[model samples]
Target chain A: MRSDVLVGAVSILFGMAYTVQTLHLPKAMVGNPWAPLFFPLALGVLLVAMGIVVLLKGLRHHPSSAKKGGSKRLIVVTILICLAYTALFERIGFIPSTILFLGGLLFAVNGAKAWIVNSLIAVTFSFGVWYVFEKIFYMNLP
Target chain B: MELIQNLLLGFSVVLTPLNLIWMVAGSILGTILGMLPGLGPTTGIALLLPLTFTMEPATALITMCAVYYGAMFGGSRSSILLNVPGDGAAVAACFDGYPMAQNGRAEAALAISAIASFIGGLIATVAFVIVAIPVARFALRFGPPEYFMLMIFALSATAAISKEALFKGFISLLVGLMISTVGIDYQTGVLRFTFGLMELQTGIDFVVVIIGVYGLGEVFKNLENIASGGGLQAIQKKFGRIWITLDDWRRSIIPILRETPVGFLVGVLPGAGATIAALMAYNNEKQLSKEPERFGTGTIEGLAAPEAANNACSVGALIPMMTLGVPGSGTTAVMLGALMILGLQPGPLLFQQHADVAWAVIASMFLGNVACAFINIPLAGLLVRVLAVPPKVLYPVIVALAFVGVYTINFSVVEFVLLILFGLVGYGMKKYKVPTAPLILAVVVGSSMEQNFRMALMLADGDFGVFFRNGICWTLFFLAIGSIAWPFLSSRIKLPWNRS
Candidate 1:
């Protein structure tokens, strides 16, 4: 029930913010000035309306706490690892950063016990793809 | 004659040694990927989009379509063997397929599934050749107002997936449209909501968003599932005899035929996809059965009906996206994006401008189906080896590939941030029970919908009444309203044959 309300409330807030942004969009000297803003504005308004319905539906449903599954810590750890990988992606270059990214994720997900297998997969994937894209396809990779 | 000529043209292109090699490779890879739990054809194509980045449109599409058919068959393989459906469309197979396997007739079950899918696919492909040209030509009459309203109808019908949470679908589509509204307004030079980022100029690529949402999002969701002790227990798969009995074919022939047309029609309708077609076909078979009680206790007819419908439904779903520019399901929506990425526009123009490409896709469907059947039938034992791969190890590879694909497209890390952002968003959307397919359709069609809408208004000189100026628009409006209302009314209305 709370998830619904939270989603609804955030939607309404975003919609309002979007509408405000739509209002400030520069008037086009070419065609009708209002034409460009029309679609976004309409979308913004519809979102608010839908959000209200969602909020009402949430309120109407018998409130039982939805027992959420999955570990937040694991998800967060994956995100942080990705962030670190992204930060180091250009600085450390493609192959090294990718190996680290894939390695960190594999280890985080699989475990320390399977480090050999995990490292092998990580190394093979990163180097194999990099070589293929850069050398064979002749496509540039950051 | 034209159909034959078109098929010959497509064959000439696809029969090349190079294209055949790609087709075989793609089919095999797609089967492996599809056997992986939680990765459907949508994810398969999205993950593989990078490899197609440099190929010719026909070659790229051939590879993708092979992947599509391979994944379709692979989805049901796991359903029969492990009772774990690899894709949503395979859920119906779980009803009787697992029970048949448990009864030690796993070989019969697998064989019949392939046979049914092949018959359904071939028939549906013939139907596609017959009808696709007419549908494309019909869509040529759609003016701006008609096209815009048609998009509205398509998106709305897609969102009406649930009776209880219609708003969730609305919110999902609105989120997609909102994302589409970013970057500079193509009509006016004004920036809508870039937030002063240079990379935001081109707006977000739907492929990146899709890879993030589907590819990464699925992995993230799987990660969550693994952590929660909800992952499927790995089973050592073994196949018995690889051929179905003559008696098995006799019982299934009727159900397969009955469901093919039903599946085809449902599949062509926007928002009703292969999953629903399979489910409906299963129910219809049960209703028509003389021994309905045998359904849950491992009946050959039960497995055959849904398998036939599942393949038919996928073939039927492609017609709209390839001809009318309205993607009927999420998988088609993803493939629609791929078609556009190939620098060809779908709809009436597709047939006129890139007729060879459009026909080639249909022609490839025939070969793709044959390829899938060949691999699935003889190579079933070899392919099921991929089932031993653990989800924990497999998901990281998907994430790495998705990000690499994203990098190849734009060469920007800003897209990576958006990928991660939408990945989380997609995960959240799934958790909340919001359908993400409508969101993909909305994103794919958002720009065109807006453009047509604005064009209609400009043509009408700001009069809103122009929407009512055409019969097609009126029909679209009526259907859109009906589509939304049907979900709510369906539960209340009692059908004569609704046993449930």
Candidate 2:
């Protein structure tokens, strides 16, 4: 349910952003009634409307199985880990950065024991995938 | 003798050490991805598409086809055991599949799906090899106006899948059309929505969007449940050998026969992808069954029908793509891109121009399906174990793999960012139950549809009714309308045959 809210907020935000961005475009001159902004503006309205409808619907239903909290923190951490991995991937290489990222996510979401076990398994699998993509398939993964 | 010789050549293609290894690897990878939540065959194929660039077209097509069949095979594995379908088509499989699992019949369920899919694929491949030539010739009769109407037919017929409001389906389609406009205009060379980024000039890579939406969004949604107390305990089940009994075969034979053609026909129609084929077949089987209420409770027919239908649909999709230059699904669209990359324009002249390549590809589907069956069948339990890998272990690996895969295409961070954004949006839309298939389909076919419409009009001096003026175009246009109308009409009047 909270996921619904977060998703709704994102939709509304993006829709508004789309609307604002398209507002700068000049209107199509009197040939085809549709302008460049016409579609975007309408889409923005529809998206905002959909978001509002979804938010309201979610509020009314109140699904009890919905998990509360923990995700926000983890999402932030996951983002940081992803950004860090992207930065580190080239220098540290695919296997190492993958180990770190997988370990970080496992620890963040499922705690440290999961982190250790998953990290080991992930490291092994990453090596296999890297071998296939990089060595066999000759994919130039940094 | 000629057919046999051609098939032998196909065997040589599949038997090559590198190609065989890739096929095995693709199935393994596809099965793993399919077992996981949120990642579907499209994501699997899209993630791996760049690998195709380096290989012979035959190897590329076979590897991708193996992955496609493997994912379809694997989709049921999770849905049966975990009640989570990695792809939408498997949702129907889960209705009965999970119940069978609960009854300690996971092996039976898995075996049935494998056999059913194998039969379906075999039927389709045979049809592809034997009938595709004449069918492609027949499809060549369609001109630009006919093509325009055919796309509309494809789009409208998809509404039949919407169990709820038809309006919602149209809304979904409208969204797809909107996304299809996100790059440079095909006619004017004017930018549509790119905010001056040079990377935007190439438009959205269909694969990236597929990865982000289907792949990333699924992870995020599953994360909440995983963090909560939603992860299951004791998924390990003891079972006898993964083989369908004679009785099981008896039950499935009729369904395979019925659904083979059903899936093929559905697959032949544009936008009615494997999921829809599977769904329709499942629904049709339920309606046909004497014990209709047995549908969601682990009926073998439930497994057999959709499994057969979806795989057959793959073959069905190729007819229009090869003959009409209109792709029926995202994977087929990518195959169309493969067609373009190989410098073989698809449409009417393709058969005359590239018969060997086209015939060889059709021939390969026969061999590929057989290879997929071998890979899937005696290995069902091992594949199901792939699902036991917890999300904590899997998500990061997939994300990293996806990122690396996308980045390696051009080594551009801008592409990565676009990939991530699409992932978030795809995830969000998926969470909200907005279907992703139409978006990609629309994008792929959009330029062609608009271009054909404009051309038809220009030929008639900008008259809108030029599309309907010709007898061929008018027949197709009405057929499109009738298809969309038939489902709604059928749903309204309870047939005399509707038992309950």
Off by over 4 Å in 1: B495-500
What CAPRI grade goes to candidate 1? Answer: high
Give the runs in model 2 whose Cα sits over 4 Å from its true position: A1-73, A86-99, A121-134, B1-15, B99-105, B141-143, B163-168, B183-187, B279-299, B334-350, B455-461, B482-487, B495-500
lDDT of 2: 0.70
Estimate, for each residue in B1-500, the C-alpha lDDT of model 2 and write its tens digit.
76667666556656668777777787777777676766778777877776776777667766777777778777877788788886877877877888888877777888888788878888887877776667667777776777888787766665334433243344455555556656765545557677777887766665566666656666666666666667754565455787778888898889988998988888887666787788878888888899988888888888888888977887788778777787767677666665555456777677667655565566556666666676666776666676677676677666766776677666776766766677666656655566666566666666567667766765776677877777877777787777667656766887532322
- Against the true structure, candidate 1 reaches a TM-score of 0.98
The local lDDT score (0 to 100) that residue B338 gets in candidate 1 is: 82
- Model 2, position B97, has a per-residue lDDT of 83
Q: Please state the Cα-based DockQ of model 1 relative to the true two-chain complex.
A: 0.80
Q: Write the per-residue lDDT of candidate 2 for residues A1-142, one digit (tens) a residue.
A: 5555664565667667766766765445543433344445666677667666656655676766853433545555666777777677778877887777766766777677655576676677678778887777787666
Best by TM-score: 1
Per-residue lDDT tens digits for candidate 1, residues A1-142, read 8778877887899889889989998888787888888899999999999899898888788877777777877788888988887789889889999999999999998988999999999999999998999887899876
Tens-place lDDT per residue, model 1, B1-500, is 98799888888888888789889889888887777779998989988988998888988888988888788788888998899998998888888999998888888888888889888888888998999989888999999999888888889889997686688889889989988888888887888788888999888899988998898888888888889876566664666667799999999999999999988898888986888888889999998999999998889999999889988888898888988987877888888888788787888898888877877778788888898888988888778878888888888888899889998888888878988998998888888777898888888889888999989988999899999897898999998999899887877886422333
